[model samples]
Target: MLGNAEILQAMEQLQDKLFQIAVRVLRKDRTRIQVSYEDHLRIFRLLQEGHKETAAQAMEAHLEFGKRILIH
Candidate 1:
C-alpha cells in the first residue's frame, strides 16, 4: 500500500540484513526502537496525507538519524 513494486523489491532485498542489525541494536537500546517506530509512523501519516515531499524529508531524517546511531 505504500510503495511501488520496485521500491518494495529494493526494501525486501535489504530486509534480512536490516532485521539482523535492528534486532542486535534494539535489544540493547529500547529507546532507539521507539524513536524509529515514531519516525515510521510520522512518515506513514505524511504519505497518507499525500505529502510526498514532506514524507520524503521525514524518511530522509529517519535514515540520517539511524545512520548516526548505527555508525561508530
Candidate 2:
C-alpha cells in the first residue's frame, strides 16, 4: 500500500507520461495541439458530474481523431 503522497506522485508521473505521449502523437511543428491541462480538468469535472461513459468515450475519440489529423 502506498502513502497518499506516493499515490499522488505516481499519478502525476503517469499524467506526465500521458501528456508526453499525447504531445508526441499530436504535435504539429513542435506545437502541442493535443489535449491541454484545462481540457483535462474539464473532463474530470464532467466525469464527477456523472458523465461516465459517453463523455469519456467522446473525448477519447475526439482526441484520437485530432491525433490522426495533426500527426499526419
Candidate 3:
C-alpha cells in the first residue's frame, strides 16, 4: 500500500492528468483552449456535481460482470 505522502502525491498527479483530459473532452481540438484558474475551478465544480453518479454506474457494471456465471 502506498504511504500517505505517496498517495497524496499520486492524487495530485492524477488531478493534473484529469484536468488535462477534462479540458480535451470539454473542448475538443479547437484553435484556442484556455484553462484559466477560474475556469479550472468552474470545471471542477461541474465534475464534483456528477462524479459520484459516474463512479456508481461504473461500479455497478463491474459488479454485475463479477456476479454473472459463464458456462462453456
Candidate 4:
C-alpha cells in the first residue's frame, strides 16, 4: 500500500493534470473573464457545507458562464 505522503503527492499530480486540461478547454473559448474571489468562496462554502453535488453543479455553471461570455 502507498504511504500517506505518496498518496498526497499522487493526488496533487492528478490535480495539476486536470487543471491543465481545464485551462486548455477554457482557453479555446478565448475568455478573458477570470474566476473571481467570490466564485472561489462560493464553491468553497458549498464544499465545507458537505454539498458536494451542489458544489460541482455550481462549478459547471461557472464554466458555462465563462464560455458564454467569450461567445458573446
User: Which has the greatest lDDT?
Assistant: 1
* Candidate 3, run of 10 with poorest lDDT: 63-72
Candidate 3 local lDDT, 4-65, one digit each (tens): 99889989999998676545543543332343334445545656787766656555553343
lDDT of each: 0.82, 0.70, 0.53, 0.74
lDDT of 1 by residue, 1-72 (tens): 385998888888799888887776676567888888898999999999999999999999877766666675
Q: How would you encode candidate 4's per-residue C-alpha lDDT over 26-52 as one tens digit per residue?
A: 676544324545676899999999999
RMSD of 2: 4.6
Off by over 4 Å in 4: 1-35
Pull out the clashing pairs in model 2.
none
lDDT of 1 at 14: 91
Tens-place lDDT digits, model 2, residues 1-72: 367898899899999987787667655544434345556677788888998886688688757765676567
Per-residue lDDT, model 4, residue 30, is: 41
Evaluate model 3: give its TM-score: 0.36
Give residue 69's error in model 3 in angstroms: 33
- Per-candidate TM-scores read 0.69, 0.46, 0.36, 0.50
Better TM-score candidate (1, 3): 1
By lDDT rank, best first, the candidates go: 1, 4, 2, 3
